[model samples]
Target chain A: MGAVLLATILAIFTTMILALWRAIAGPSVYDTIVGVNVFGTKTVLLIALITYFSGNDDLIDVALVYALINFLAVIAVLKLIRQRDLAAAPEGGDD
Target chain B: MTELILDVVSGLLLLGGAAFAVIGGIGVMRFPDIFTRLHAGGITDTLAPLLIVGGLVLQSGFTLLTFKLLLILLFLLFTTPAASHATARAALVAGLQPVTRDSTDQKETRSSNS
Candidate 1:
């Protein structure tokens, strides 16, 4: 509703767009992981702003839950990627 | 008078947070390697939230809303860095190496089709 809040949200949207670039255009899988992580962080912030703008304090609880879930998502992705890489690696090598 | 001061202070903080977040985003696109991009992104995870949430907390004053804002900040402070560290370490464990400065061999580029 306020000018500042609206601008903040717009800036956040642009930030997400930049992160989307990384997610879609990656030389390595790690880039996508980083992109997704950054995007999640922005989403949390956006939710926080929305909560304040709407005067609905209840949404703060939602933001908190999202932050926790985002952390779990990153950890899970990293763990899975590491495991996949190890599995794909050859156990025996040529001398 | 106090309301005016509060409005000004919160406005400044919100603007600062937005500026930092967008800068970090641009850096994420510009940086050459995954590690460097993470460094850029870490700013958004930490500083932007600190400022933005702090601004919101100030706007809410001492109330249940402020408490919720504090909770959000606490969670952000504790988890964001942890996620970044875990992701970076996992990348290393998975045999992903940063591009060496001196060699200038591989050029990390976006997917052409995308």
Candidate 2:
């Protein structure tokens, strides 16, 4: 069971590396944001798995906090993107 | 025997999820535009995490930790799509074009606008 769990962790880590590549080389800003979001989710999963393997259930709380923060960061970034769009719109009655 | 079966099943699910995530990353890397990349990212963001959390829950048994993991999964399912939608909308508003199989629509729009 430990071996299987370790293998799962390793697979997830590899996936994270691939996601990092996407984040670094994505074609647009939003794609990069997507990469970041995926990374955060994986991090939460990794934390939870580690906690389970280590027999320290208390770490689940940390995973929860991380998830909450990740969600907020994504929201904030989206809001910033929206603000930027509003600022960039043509001033003359183009809408 | 039950424990062994559970472990194997969980392992397979975890592996499958990880594979999907990697495929998503590849799609993001290779896709021509932001919208398709967002599609790939969205898949991995929601499905992959859920699978992994599910696997962890199976392994965690009936414990507080399992409950927390389930909560995390629930939260992710609730939030990731909203985030992806907002980001995609923002990108569209900011003028990022979706790559299409044919250029006729783009040309028509551009000529019509001009």
Assess each prediction's global lDDT (C-alpha) against the native. 0.84, 0.76
Off by over 4 Å in 1: A84-95, B102-114
Give stretches of model 2 more than 4 Å off: A84-95, B102-114
lDDT of 1 at B98: 68
DockQ (C-alpha based) per candidate is 0.53, 0.47
Q: Which candidate number would show the highest TM-score if scored against the true structure?
A: 1
> For residues A1-95, could you state the per-residue lDDT of candidate 2 as single tens digits?
67766776777687678778877865566767877887888788888778867878788899999999999998777776666553354435542
Kindly report the docking quality category of candidate 2.
acceptable
Q: Could you tell me the interface RMSD of model 2?
A: 3.5
Give the worst 10-residue stretch by lDDT in candidate 1 chain B. Answer: B105-114
- Per-residue lDDT of B1-114 in model 2, one digit per residue for the tens? 999899888888777777776777677666667777778887778778877787777887888777788889889889888888888877777777665667545442210110
Q: What would the TM-scores of all predictions be? A: 0.87, 0.83
Residue-level error in angstroms, candidate 2, position A87: 14
